[model samples]
Target: MDYRRLEKIKRILQRRQPDLTLITDNVNNFRNLSAIIRSCEAVGTMEVHLVNNQQEKLYLINKVTAGAERWLTQTRHSSIVTGINHLKKRGFTIYATHLGDPEGICCAVRTLDYRKMDYTKPTAFVVGSEKKGISEEALENADYHISIPMMGMTQSLNVSVATAIILFEAQRQREEKGYYQQLRTSQEIYEKTIFEWAYP
Candidate 1:
């Protein structure tokens, strides 16, 4: 194995945020799902929580991910509620991406700008289905609702693009906070990831 390649993977592992992760609720497209996984890898996301109540089947397209799927850790759940509750117990603050009035998502309560929210802590973002958006139960379970500001006639972004945008914002916030500068993951896991990346 090349020492340079090993060093590169080691650097990435050091920056991996064990506290930061993503959740998908009923996203049906394999391409979109794989793209989300690619974005998660780019941002050094530790894990992905998938809620596929529609069916137990979940697929990740290799064409879309271009081999990125093998690098990401994913867990399957029967329902969004179960995933959200588990993350909550693990000290993660869940945020759901939904479109509504910025002043208030559902009512006049006030929705947050994705950039303004603190990502320095344990944060998990739930991106919903392309057609139906997030489920009501998922929205209700979220600690906050976040949205990207839009000005054009079309009010929505593709699920994969939206996931990338929010995750990059999180990457930015975590970078500014020096969250990525220190080692945050367990040594055993880090070693495992490096071996997988380096050997494979």
Candidate 2:
């Protein structure tokens, strides 16, 4: 590990608070889940909600997260519908990202939001499976629906790759606005997570 780069990242993490939450709605592959966990951590997300019932599948995600899964929090849910409602009740503006249209998104988040920062607010984002895309429950419950524009012959990007691209753009925009200027969490959480992330 590059100590300097790690320090730089730690500093950015100290100040950078991205108002993003991830929901895995029936995504079937362990590799994709692990990749998504990697992307989520890289982009500064610490909590992700998983909606899966199978114990075998959840365990498979450990292989993909590369133990970064240990650095973040994961919640299990029986239904995506219930999760969306819960997030909404907490004042999160739930966004469902897909490949269908270019007009609705506001920034370049999991979907784009055109508005400026109220960074202290809570937000939640949902990523769909590779083959089926966003589910109907997410679509019905989300406050906004978004898509990434593609010029290639391919219609959609891989789920993990798409997650990294979208999340980094959100991080990039947040960083410029001095979003990471202050520590957001308790020092205990900060120390514990950083140490676990570095040493584990």
Candidate 3:
């Protein structure tokens, strides 16, 4: 809740033009989805596009996202391929979260595990549940793929926790590059989100 830092984030977002996104491939867990929403807010992402086959669980999503959902604009679609198409239409370089081959998540990720990333352009991150990770459609559509560097004996982080690490790392990187120092949305939307998040 650093106002100055938020202001700096605004400037950085404007200059770097980082459109960090979280895409779910048939993610059925509301808690995990909700946690991802919270992480997105912490990382200065204004929007989230969700792809699901059903909408009956909207109330569940709202509950899990809590009030954080108000600050983050979430859009939904009927399918993963449809969602990917939408993001691509908007110029995002879609990235699917898959197990990498000991290579950096992206074309130029760091070895530091939590290295700073550059989000100066449109970037979309895709995450799936452990049971089904990234779907075939999502993997096929992604421009790049990434996986967590698990030094421990365990194989993975919970979906939500993994999202937190990945997004915060991107956020941290964007901070260093000063990507959040610019305005990415209209003043009306910005003020509205701030007021809701600040007061709610």
Predicted model with the maximum TM-score = 1
TM-scores of the candidates are 0.92, 0.77, 0.75
Error of 1 at 34 (Å): 0.8
Could you give candidate 1's per-residue lDDT for residues 19-121 as a string of tens digits? 9899999998888999999999889887899988776677778888887777778999889999999999999999999876675644554668777788888
Off by over 4 Å in 2: 1-18, 53-57, 60-63, 103-121, 186-200
Could you give me the TM-score of model 1 versus the true structure? Answer: 0.92
Sort order, TM-score high to low: 1, 2, 3
The digit string of per-residue lDDT tens for model 2 on 88-195 reads 777788768777646544434354432332333576778898888878888888887766677788988898887776676677766776666778767887777677
lDDT of each: 0.88, 0.72, 0.70
- Per-residue lDDT of 11-34 in model 3, one digit per residue for the tens? 533442337787877677777888
Distance from true location, Cα of 174 in model 1, Å: 0.9
What's model 1's overall lDDT?
0.88
Lowest-scoring 10 consecutive residues by lDDT in candidate 2? Answer: 111-120
